[model samples]
Target: AITQAEISVQELATHSGQIEASNKALDDIAKQINMFALNATIEASRTGNNGQGFSVIANEISKMSRSSHEMLGKVTSSLFRVKEKIDATTAVFATSHAEASRGVELGSGLTDIFEDLLEKANAANDSLGSINESIQSQFSSLANIQNSSEELATVAEKNAASANMVASVTEETAAAVEYVTRSAMELTRISESLSQSIPTAKMFDEWQPDDSNEKASQ
Candidate 1:
């Protein structure tokens, strides 16, 4: 018993839209959080010693936001990732009418490992979404990062700027940091690509917003 491929196509389109909307929402949340830092600065300046406690809290939050900004930065740096998946999914959808949709087959040994990934993706997504909501402070510092690309002459220029900051903080050259970032990006792409190719994941083959949906392997 089966239905039309058009229905599946429709569903895939809807899912893709949802994922894009969620990413945009997260970006906006980041912007709002970044704005909080400005208010925090003003408050600290006004309150003086009283604001010291607030400043300390704000500092901790700024650190967290820095981390969040880095994480989102890394993700944005790889936006082409989701786009590739979207393209692949679109190809699959096009062929869904031409060929039978095959669910990945699981067997003796690799089953346990496959199950673990599915569990992790689900648990991470569930917890991440909740924790993301609960944190009001972490996004404050990242507000300005939204348009960093717009202001930047190039990624290399951004890297040089980061390099200068790193040198000031830790004595690293801008060129060195750029090398590190480029290598890191390449390494991450390779690793992510490898993980995506897992036979279990290849089955049930849904384009997830994050690895959190590994449960779809079910």
Candidate 2:
């Protein structure tokens, strides 16, 4: 819009120049008419009484020329004032255009800065989202590890109980073996005493204890 106003101001200045030139031409024509009127007054005076009408006509022509000259002077003065105003207006338009251009540049720069900031903000948001996902995944893995650890603890408890049962059974078997050994030694002593007290012991001498039972006792 400022550009359009500036163009219009320039066109107005051009038209003002043209109007001033035309006013100058009209002033020159008025001067020429005044000179012609003066020549006619001189000629009419030389012709004496016969030229009174010619003299009156020449005076009217002179009056009309003076009025035209005065009007032209006023028009020239007005044109000068209009030209000064046009020059001032043109300068104002030029300054406005410069300021407007600078404002546009500043606005564009601000827009670019805002866009950069927005892009960085979006990137930061994406990074935060990724970090959140990673944290969630790690939390899930930790829960799985905890479950596995609990299962391992349960299995260890069961194994310890089984070991204790085995140890108790082993102790019982050892006690039973000790009692059988004492019974076997008593039986051997009784048999030896019976043999010394009896004459038929010689016949029993051919009989022997079973080898399997002796091995088991040993």
Candidate 3:
């Protein structure tokens, strides 16, 4: 369970990093769009009567670029918060896994102790005939050991149950990480699609990294 959680965390970290890079690229492209729009507006204004349509288009483009920038900013902030939560959850899972492993070890050790106690009890019974004078006292000791063993067994059962529950929760978390990975990929695709519609976007695309590493199969 610990190993699985660790793998999930590593994948989540990689996905988060890819999303961060894409967001940065989107932001850069949006800024360039805004700059182009601003220059177009200036040139349109200098053209007198013939530039009204161009000016209106430039104004709309500027507004769109600003809106895209703001939207990306909000998304980036949200992703940061999500990454923080995932980190916290990963820490929690790691702690739980450690505790569960320790519980199993302790339970196994207790079982071994109980088996030794039982063996000793049987040996005592076998020799009871020769020591009849102290038979009652030896029987009492055997009963106490038996009772203690039962209680220890019960405790071990409870520990096993707790460990199972932790494993189940870890599986659910792994599923959530998978969902997040898909969502991040979809966001990347949408960002790319949006960029293609903007003027001079190709230049910004050229500035982006190959992204092959980011898109490698999980």
Runs with alpha carbons beyond 4 Å of true place in candidate 3: 1-6, 99-218
User: Candidate 1 residues 56-108, lDDT tens each?
Assistant: 54455455455765665544433334434444544544443233223333233
- RMSD of candidate 2 to the truth, in angstroms, is 69.4
Ranking 1 against 2 by lDDT, winner = 2
lDDT (10s digit) by residue, model 3, range 1-218: 22332444455445546646655654554454445445544544654565455445445545544554454455555445544544444444344345444443334543343344334323322332222322233233323323332332333333443334323333433343343344445664533432232213232222222234334522
lDDT (C-alpha, whole model) for all candidates = 0.39, 0.40, 0.41
Q: Please give, for residues 13-47, the per-residue lDDT of candidate 2 as tens digits.
A: 55446545644654554455445445544544554
RMSD of each: 16.0, 69.4, 35.7
Clashes of 3: 0
Sorted by lDDT (best first), the order is 3, 2, 1
Error of 2 at 115 (Å): 37
Location of the lowest summed lDDT over 10 successive residues in candidate 1? 165-174
| Candidate 1 Cα errors over 4 Å, as ranges | 1-10, 74-80, 95-218
